[model samples]
Target: MGVRGLTTFVKNPSYTHDGSTTLLRPHQLSNTPVVIDGKGLLQWLYFENDVDCKHGGDYREYETICTEFIEALHQRGVKPFILFDGASNPDDSKVDTLLGRCRERIQDSAKIIDGDPESPKLRPPFTTAVFLKVLESKEVGYVFCDFEADSEIVALANIMGCPVIGNDSDFFVFDLTGGYIPLSSLRWKEARQLSIPCEKYSLDHFCQAYSMRREMVPLLAILLGNDYVSRETFDDLYHRVIKRSGNIPNGPNVRIPRTIRFLQSRQNFADGAKRLLKDEARRQGKEECIEKSLQAYHIAPESRYQAYLQQDPSMVDIPDCPLPAAYVDLYRRGAFPADYINLKFRNNRKKLLPNLVEDYIRPSCHLISQRIREAIYGILLHGLHDRAVQETGREGQDIKVFIVTGMPSLPEFGSLPNLERMIDLEEERRKVLVMEVLEVDHGRVQAIRDDLKLPVATTIYWRSKLDLPVTESGHHLMRVILLGIAICYSREDLNMDDVKGNLKEAPRVMNRTAVQAFAEWQSCMYYTMHLNTLVNRPYPTPDATKLYHGTLLHRIYATTRLQRDVNPDWVETDVLRGSPAALALFRHLDGVAQNQ
Candidate 1:
């Protein structure tokens, strides 16, 4: 959602910089406070960790990466205030943008399957949940804005008199009192010392370099292209208003400099707005569009999260609805997932994660996790007027919105636990409810650790729903889950001499059958984890960091499938050599599934 090519423009010395321009200053980033864009950091950290996105995500490895990052920041004496974006417009204003991104991810996945060495990465579901868990464990300060976090982030940074750490080009338009530190220029990872060298950009430098007024920055952003205004919308306007514009190149990269030069020539935003509005035939409502786009860069004097961050809830802006007070508190603490809010307000849930499995030939990975999602949606939209959730998965042929009506009809699920009561239910009752939701035998999961129950139950459900055979493909999925259990849950019960950290090996091409089976397993875990969160301590949330490594699991799957005469010795070395107990546990779990 950054301004297209704005990052490149800002970095170019010729466009908005001189040899002595202090737009980007070399600064030390220790012993200071900064407000970080949580969403931007999430995506950056995911790709940086090299987590396998083509398969499911490797949460265990991702957790390690995030933990180390936070720890590094803390060791450098940097107090970070992280801000996250919550539900978008209830009216679905961003659906087209969301769908467009989904289509790109779909094509990227296809390229990877066709042997592209390095394709753009897709994020797996639950990546956010894992990151939040890491933050909570580290005791970092963070909050979720009601909608977009940009304005709130700017407000808080100005209030705290600290720089903002993020890569969004929109930050260039927002006038921060301290400055903005683009993540690309920050050397936070090289935390070998107390002070990390980084580059800080200030609005003052931008204005001085361009010889333009501060008020005209937003106008320039809108004209260049932003999430609100398409660059194409203003192309004709640029042609009509500018004289001798033929010198400017005709490409996306030229938009930034061209817009800046136009704004620089005018006295003010009002002066530029007057000429741009003169062309009535080019586009109707041009005046209104410019005004609306300007609002995207508005920075309020006080952020909505300001009081909440100061531990004062009275001034927080909670929505005027009958949403449970407990849920509102969770939202304030950034403990709640944004999807629940979208379902409550929009009655529409769209999942755009492109699992490599093709949607045109078979049902979406979402369909396999429908039951779990339905239960969560039931808890979220309980007494609201909308009793059904419209779920959108892939783009073509697949139904646009699969309406999931009512709660799951499992035994004792008739009166789904409301938000208030969900968190206070008895441990035994919570276990029973979660077991019912998964359609697993109570006796089987009743003995498992509270944190392990949901994942174990999910594996059982996955196996039963898919009716996977005893072939290597099916067993490979089981082996990965068991290894995860031993690592995260039974640390003392198994040896670890044979297991190495995930190797930095290129992903091997896996057969479609194996790929699809694991995708379904990942979907099951993702939805089940969310459902468990909604229902409160039903099963203690599992340690996601120990649960899966996408590359390691994929490597195991491919090795077994490729070899003609693989043996248990290979399995022991690659999957189970260090954990005889893990293999035994899986056997018992499988035995229970067989008897059931």
Candidate 2:
């Protein structure tokens, strides 16, 4: 029988009554022997130091969950097996100690075996050492696996065959498709059910169904948007455009007044010190001594410092202010100050504060909006439409889809009726009959019955606000197109040659230039805003020139123009490209293109 459990039981051979009067034979006969293998099931669980455990609860909770799960399996006639990392918890060493106690408690009733006999069970070895000595002396069937070191020990059950059991999804992610079976939640029900289909899903089928490129999930995440670059870039670009346009209206003149006051205060301090020194010189009976004393400190024989002090001594001793050491250190370390850091730390914090706020915080707030757009694109590409075709092996002429956005009364729905009417008009006039928008609404969508009035089979609602820039909209649309292509290719099992052939004859909706331009614009804007915040603020940097060469600005301009052509009334493009901002953006683009 295939059993999934915490441990394998070795039947005591001494209890057998087969006329072989041997003690081992009797014990083996009395119990149906099974050996639990730890090695085979190591991939099912992840062992990390307690510090890395982000989920709620401690090692005690983990032990409780495991124990309960194992007990439930035992009640269902399925054997339970337990595996543990030899390493103790980082925070508390007692995790391993407590687990050893649990193992001893269960071992008296069930089959008990030591994985590593030599390894000390406690910090100061005691009971486990005594137990190991007893088991070894008797020559019992208990096998001690060679797990002396701190590495993960894999115990392979010696029984002919056994089903591996676990509820961890990481097993599927890792593509462990051997004799594995899920101990599903349904197993805990009052009426135990044994004949469940616990077959491992084929990795190839999972990848194909999801339209995932081989081992490219991390890459896709980076491209779509990640915490590191995309967010930072968008923030940078937004601040740059805002700063260059001088749209911020609230603050005092950060540059002129502060500089003047700061300089004048230093000048007053220098003058006061000079006057006091002159008084000291006069008191010491040397009328010309103050000049000679100041002269001694001058670097040059013909000192500009002396000359400056003679003319305006108050302003002369003001220090030559270099950039802050902390800022320089941060720059060398390749970390830009976050918005809060810029606002709080460094000298001249006020001057650069607005840029940081606009760049970092504003862009971060929009990440969810961007993700929502990407999710919409994902749904259109990989959701039920592709699955229906793949499973049925039939590509229907018209696929009905329902997109539920959960927005009850968005203003954008007002335009949907007109869009649907236009699609109907175009289908009749062109006779192509390729695509259609069947229905438009701003409320919860219900399935269409045979007698329903709705003409379109697929229903998609717009729940979120649609305030995204035209460039972003175009980028999203391109992703949708790519997803559509991927889905078609995935379903048809088309080879590279077949895909190329289809591409050649595929209806050209958007040109390469237009698509490229939109992508470039989005990237540029993101970077430009990011750089402006880094430079204008008290952020650290080694080489500001190397940082802001304008590749991003160039891309933004090119992409924005393309986006403008596609949708003329987008105010963001106009706002972003206003006089000074436009000149700065164009200058950067020109520099990059020339270098290219």
Question: Which predicted model would earn the best TM-score?
Answer: 1
Tens digits of per-residue lDDT for model 1 on 1-596?
A: 56777777777635553454346888888988889999999888988768777766778778888898898888888988899987775656556667666667767656655556776787876688789898889988888888888989999999889999997999988999989999888787775587888898998888888777888887777777677556677767767764333257665566566767767777455664645643432365545555555776788887777666666766445574445666676776655667677766655565444344443344666677778877777777667655676666654433355677657345664677677777677877767777888888688866665666677788888866774445544445565555445544445555444444322243566455556666787788877877776766556776666666565556555554555223445545554556777666655554444453
Whole-structure CA lDDT of model 2: 0.26
lDDT of 1 at 179: 96
Structural similarity to truth (TM-score) of each candidate: 0.88, 0.17
Candidate 1 Cα deviation (angstroms), residue 105: 1.9
Estimate the TM-score for candidate 2: 0.17
Model 1 bad stretches (over 4 Å): 13-22, 243-252, 269-289, 310-317, 346-361, 383-386, 395-400, 408-412, 420-427, 467-476, 487-497, 500-507, 562-575, 578-584, 587-590, 593-596
Error of 2 at 518 (Å): 63
Each candidate structure's count of clashing pairs = 2, 45
Residue-level lDDT of model 2, residues 1-596, one tens digit each, is: 01111111111111112322211111100112222222222212212112102110122223333344334444445543332222122222132333334344333211111222232211100112222222233322222211111111112221223333444322222232233344332234343344222333233433343333333322222111221213222233224432343222434322212222222233435555345434544554533434532321222212122222123323212122222443333222223222212222212111110110011112221232232222222222222222111110001211112222311112332221111132234322211111111123312212322211111111011112223444455333332222222222232232424323322222122232323322222332233223322223211211211111122222233344434322222311342223343334323322222222
